[model samples]
Target chain A: MKTDSEIIITLSDVWKSFGTQTVLKGINLSVIDGKTTIIVGPSGQGKSLILKHILGLIKPDRGQVLFEGKDINAIQKKELNEIRTKIGVLFQNAALFDSMTVFDNVALPLREKTVASESEVREVVDEKLSLMDLRGSNDKYPAQLSGGMKKRVGLARALVLNPRIVFFDEPTTGLDVALSNEIYRFFFKTQEKLKYTAVIVSHDVPKIFKLADYVALISDGVIQDCLSPEDFQMSSNPIIKNFVEATMGTIYSSEAMEV
Target chain B: MLNFVEKLGAYVLYYVNEAGRMGIFLFFSLLNIIKPPYNKIASVLKQIYVIGSLSVFVIIFTGAFTGMVLGLQGYNTLTKFGAEGLLGSAVALSLIRELGPVLSALMVTGRAGSAICAEIGIMRISEQIDALECMAIDPYKFIMAPKFIAGIISMPLLTALFDVIGIFGGYAVGVGLLGGNAGAFFSSMQSDVEFIDVYMGFVKSVCFGLLIVWLCAAKGYYVHLERKGGFGAEGVSNVTTSAVVLTSVSILVMDYFITSMLI
Candidate 1:
């Protein structure tokens, strides 16, 4: 439904290489506002690298990453940081501060980027934590939490700022099937409610397609195609077909392909 | 011979590049400190507790033992020349001018500096630093500047504590156990130990504090870039060990330069 919406982020002919290994070669993609864009690719195929580029964590070897019609890479540091406050990122492994408690971890961005009073911070943190089903775990350190709990906390932290956009880098990499399903459910509910633009790099294959408005298949360091989940499942392109079959073939029940 | 020369050149270039990188890192870290929206006071206070208060027990223990040895040795040496009354002056001057700062720095390096390195190195490897950057939180301002401030604040105080405890330690041994005159001990120390001696120790402690924190924090911050820093837990461990060793060596080397200039 949002396919007709305006584009919020555009990556134009981005080229990035590390030493002798070229990771992203002349890749281009666009993210529509208030839509979930899921990026799927084989590991080490620079799937996560694309997220880093959009976030300005790493510079492309060449080309531009535009956010709301402005070139993020060419902007001033203060402006870039200001742009960053409007976007949230959930990295793989959660990346929670080991020294801070779960509550402080979630409250970090609000505390750092906003002038919210402690009571306001507590109110927001509590609401987010409750949504993440992390109530009563405020005093727990990241080391004390389970893999599923850490991911939920990470998601809570990412959402605390009510960012206009969010990027998830393999949010459920280590969770069990039930836990992964729970996280995906949380993702779906949050994305549905918040209506924020989302760019997720995931390995969950067919299951991930359920939450995607657009699915971009990346192979050989370039996006093969950006299609709706339904069209992606039915595409005849060999690369996309093989990728789909290779990932979905393992769990290929007739019903599982309908996402 | 040709291969040896090539390897030697490579080593020299690597060290030079590393030194340059560290200088730039320090420059940027200082810039972050002076920039607006300064680091929170609570963060600095927490660092003060970790770096200063936590190291108190070891500093006191080491300072006491060092002064006791100085008292026992100084008394023995001066008595040979019928100058036993000068033992208090010798112990007090040696402690206030040199041992207090250098030894205390080494102790804190072992206790707090290594932990700081390991903590930051772990955060680096774990992507916490990158996460902070993603959240628009300046990693240097949030994580590093506070530690630097804490180090500068704590080092002089710790060195002063070391000197005071050392002086009393010397008294406990010289007057109580060695049967030396208690009044002669205090009087000689008061007469011979001038303000310059105290000033020298303060300067050395402050300098050593900065060196310890700067080198340790930089080493950990750049662990990913180190040629042998590897990745994962092994990388953190290797970088932390190197940071402690390097900081200790740098403290000693900087001590000599400061002393040579002041003395």
Candidate 2:
């Protein structure tokens, strides 16, 4: 329904290899502003690698990663850090700082990057924690939190700065179906409210499809195709068809047995 | 012969590359320290407490024992020449010149250095470091700079404490136990030990502190690039072991060079 689609991040012919193994041969993708673009793939297909490239955590061997038309890899450290401030990342394991309390973890970026006062930091931290329904859990460390709670806290920290672009790497990876749905609902409400450009790499498959404006299938070190969710399911490309059918079949068959 | 030469060449290249990488890491760590937005006083104080205060008991225990052994041995040896009154000078000169700094450094390398490596290695493996990067905060400034400051400040103070405690231990063994002339012990030590000897100890402690932190932190920070067991809990343990061993060896080696230069 939103018509003003503008591209925010562009990965052009990116290639990467680690030691003897080639992880991404050549990856080209565009992330549109204010939209949820979900990347789904089999394991080791370079889905997370792409997100890292966009975040400047990894550099490509062959091509450029353009953020708002500036090559992130080509920029200086200060500029790159400046660019990173506009971004948020939710790692698969939640990756909260173990030494810090939940409040500190959520308030870190604001304190480090902004000129916010202590009172301002407290107010913002409280607001973000409340947003995640973690109002009373600010003092708990990551080791004390459950998986679902950690995930929610990770989201809270990610959105604390109100970053323009949020990257979720397997956000619902270890959660049960009910928890996954609950997380998705949070995703929906936050995205609707904050309007952040979301680039999520997930394995939740069909359930993840509901949150995506566009779905990209990564396979064999390249994106096979990127299409709308409805068209992705109906994609005639054999790779996309096989992936969609296999995942859907697995989920549906498992559900039927339970029923 | 060709295979042996090939292996030799590989070993040489690997060590050269690693040394260069370590040098670069130290350079950047130093550079980050001098850059703006310095670490908070509280963070540095916490590291000082962890690296300095926590190691006090061990340093005292070891220093006392080392000096007592020196006193017992020196008293017996000097008695041969009827020079047993020089016990205090012998103990003070040896401790202030060499043993105080070197032994204290080795202790810290075992206690604080290994723990620092393990902690940073765990953080590296867990992606907490990566998360810091994603948040646009410099890990060097946030995590490492405080430690470097603490190490530099703590080492000299710890070395001083070790020397003082060791001198007392020697006095107790020589004058109290052996019934040596207490006035002669104090006078000989005062006359023989110069400021330069104390200066040498201070210099060595500072260098040893920097070396311990630099090597241990680098080893842990780059745990992902470790050659063996670089992906899990195994990786952390392997790197921590290497860090402690490497730092210990380097401390002894550095002590020799510094002594040769300054002495």
Candidate 3:
């Protein structure tokens, strides 16, 4: 939707498959800068696979994942790491380090990546956890927290570095509707302050789109539609129509309202 | 028939790949150990605590019993040969050259090797490893090198402890319980058991330490997730089993080659 916007990453003619099943087939997509691009898809579809390519976690069998005009596959290890520092990812499972407490888990990036003093780390961690509504849970371990709390802590960790971009994998998974909306508002407020692009993939279609500047739906190893939420809701494609209908029961477009 | 050949070929290739991969892993882990910022003192000590200190009781238990059995058996055999004065030499040589290192290796393999495999494998499946990569921390250097360095340092120390305890256990049984002369037992041991025998045990202990820690970390790191026993809890368990079994058998097999060469 933001065609003139600067693109952070582009997947051109990319293809991937697992064993006998093809997951991504000749995909072409671009992520606009400073805006939220929600990659909405069915469960077990190639959304995570696409996210992996963007993060340079996995290379496509064909084509390329280009980040800031450089092919992630062709970049040297040092160069790739330089690119990685600018990006943060929230995995589907939160993936907190079990050996460390919640405080240590969030403090890991600061300790590992920066030369900040212990007091500085404590101060940053305190602010981030407070923003994520996880101030008092620092002493607890990841194993003891609920899924939603883990997701919040993961968000805090991701934002602690204030990377230029962050990827959220199912950020609203276990939380109720109210909590998901509250988390979204919190994330937006942080985004407004921090000014970073975010790309998220979620199955929580209707509620998740509330934060999206663009919604891209992938199915059958191809992206079927990439449009604004209103345009996506009015997509003529049957797959998108069925998905939107199933998740929303009924769809009304702003364009239709304008008409 | 073609399918069967293809399957056989694939299995063989898989093993060859794994072998080559393990070889590279060992090389890198050891290489990173010497080349670095050199600030792993805390991590190395933590590993030593796990690999050396925590494993004391088991090592001592194994050493004591092996020595007691040797004392009884050696005395019985030497008396029949009219060489009862040689009992201490026989027990000392046996403990210092073979039982001490081999039993310590096996016990450490069970106590520490399986644990290293499970911990690394769990980290892999849970995306903690990926998180480390995302954070630009090399899991190999950060996670594995300490285990290797600690194992190399601790195995010999543990083996020496085992040897000492076994000899004492032999003294307890032979000199106090049995009718062997304490002077002959202690004096004969002092004269007959040279420094070389104890040196051989130390060398073997170091080798076993390298094999156990390296193989366990490699197995856990590269446990193939695409295969049935390659992901999740089942995968970690399977890899841990293989690491312990493979490392134990490897130590035993290499012990023969090493002994053959040394002797």
Taking the tens digit of each residue's C-alpha lDDT, what string does model 2 give over A1-259?
Answer: 3232488888888999987899897888888898899999999888888988888888899999999889999999999998999999999999999989999999999999999999999999999888888989989999999998899899998998999999999999889988888788888888888989999999888889989899999999998888899778877788887898798975544443455
After superposition, the stretches of candidate 2 with alpha carbons farther than 4 Å from their true spots are A1-5, A250-259, B1-12
Predicted complexes: DockQ each: 0.78, 0.82, 0.67
* Candidate 1 wrongly placed segments (more than 4 Å): A1-5, A250-259, B1-13
Per-residue CA lDDT of candidate 2, range B140-258, in tens?
A: 89888888989999999999989989998998998889998899999999999999999999999999999989999989998988765487999999999999999999999999999
**lDDT for each candidate structure:** 0.89, 0.90, 0.87
Indicate whether candidate 1 or candidate 2 has the larger lDDT.
2
Ranking by lDDT: 2, 1, 3
| Structural similarity to truth (TM-score) of each candidate | 0.94, 0.96, 0.94
Q: Which model scores highest in TM-score? A: 2
Q: Which ten-residue region of model 2 chain B has the weakest summed lDDT?
A: B222-231
